[model samples]
Target: MNALTVNLRSVLELTDEQFFQLCQANRDLRFERTATGELIIMPPTGGETGNRNARITQQVMNWTDADGTGIAFDSSTCFKLPNGADRSPDAAWIQLARWNALTEAEKEKFPPICPDFVIELLSPSDSLKVAQEKMKEYIENGVRLGFLINRKSRQVMIYRQGKEVEVLESPATVSGEEVLNGFVLNLAMIW
Candidate 1:
């Protein structure tokens, strides 16, 4: 059997302004700001991982509409955090009320607010520790819910404010609980 070679690049630490400029320059790079003020820029996904993430995002979006909660967005969209940081999740959601409260201009421009829910799909090249830290940061920054989807193990870890983190393994369904009422996503379907 032949060994597969993985090309991993060193993570470049960046300031908030530098991170913004990097984002502006590279349309394909995805950036995540760590709680300790480190910036991680990752290359775009290819092959199975990308397809799985896209399928999961679509499933979540469909579940949101079927549950009658609000709108869901794929990774292409970015959310502006309270701090001067902009990060994109694999998937995001916003309730109708909070979204409607935004001004037309705010809606048109990047909404300077945290998403109601965030999902991070793990890639082979991703650092699990870094991803989990980012998810924690999102919760601290006012994201009501977060899901860390690990494709390797096919597990979904759910995070909520003032509660213990819940790990929902494959063959189980993850629910939004009260944060997004009536929204239930089956892990098996997406995985």
Candidate 2:
């Protein structure tokens, strides 16, 4: 089934705590809030998509483990963006110091901060335009670098702060560049 968006724009916005409760009440579903307070209910990905997502997160987390400069998160970890949207990228990273600055309570809920680096893998059900726009939103919300990987087309879109998006076609691997400090994403499993 396709994902659904429910508009709650006319009503009072849900507080972060209220949103958390709503999510808790619906444990099996993935929920997200748009800046304007629309509730997004995402469908679970297909088996192949799930496998690719796992490999993508694994590679990124491995890099974070070795680099020791940041913490990595899989798709389930949501962040309350500065623009008021709650977003969960496919794979995300935050610098160690920045993550450490949050209080335990803040960390427990959707952390009210953007990730330093974000990646979105385009599944068959996802719209390429929407995914690219989400990547742009991450960049706008203070993420230093973002990657939009499309396995079907074998194209990857690189988004960097203050720079034009760089697109790579049929790339076997992608560099994390200065933002990730020498980490490289081997796209073999993902592709």
Candidate 3:
């Protein structure tokens, strides 16, 4: 006898409240919003991608923990942008003071404010153009620093306020500068 296999397609397109409710009900769902406000729900990562992100998040956490400068969150957390958009960056960092000012309930809910630093990791399914546009949205919405990490090319593009975006090629490092003092990330180690 031969066994049949089935692959369940993920959900796509949802209302804002429906998206939040779905996320609350399912801890494993990874939700992202497009420029057109459509919701994309994806299954959790399986192997290398998950491991790499875990390591990178740890590095970010360690740096923040030591310096007491910011708080970091993995992709599961969502940030509410200025334009009524909800974004889930691969990783995010918010300044300590700003984070501390929120009430406990506010911390429990989706943050209504922008993060100081946002990081997006490129997956095989992601479009670089779309990712760059999302990064620009974050910057325009008050994100002081943003990094787009492309594992395929081992490059990181740094976005800062009132300046041209800077791309760091392989073997270089990215810093948070004034946004997150003493927070430095080496792309070589991350990829």
Best by lDDT: 2
- Candidate 3 per-residue lDDT, tens place, 1-191, comes to 11122222254455556657777997855666554565656556657778878877887888888988678898888876768778888889998889999888778777777898888887766678878988899999899899888889888888998789988888567877887787788666667
Q: Mind giving the per-residue lDDT tens digits that candidate 1 earns over 1-191?
A: 11122222256455555655666787766655544455555677868778878877887788887876677888877677886556788889988787888898777545667888988988887778878877888888888999998878878888999788888778467787888777776676567
lDDT tens digits by residue: candidate 2, 1-191: 66698987687678989999989899899998888788999899999889999998999999999999999999999899999999989999999999999999999999999999999989898988888888888999999999999999999999999999999999988999888988899998988
TM-score of each: 0.79, 0.97, 0.84
RMSD of each: 5.2, 1.0, 5.7
The TM-score-based order of candidates, best leading, equals 2, 3, 1
Best by TM-score, which number? 2
- lDDT score for residue 102 of model 3: 84
Measured by TM-score, how close is model 3 to the native structure?
0.84
lDDT of each: 0.75, 0.92, 0.77
Show how many residue pairs clash in every candidate, following the order shown.
0, 0, 0
Better candidate number, 1 or 3, judged by lDDT: 3
TM-score of 2: 0.97
Q: Which candidate, 1 or 2, has the higher lDDT?
A: 2
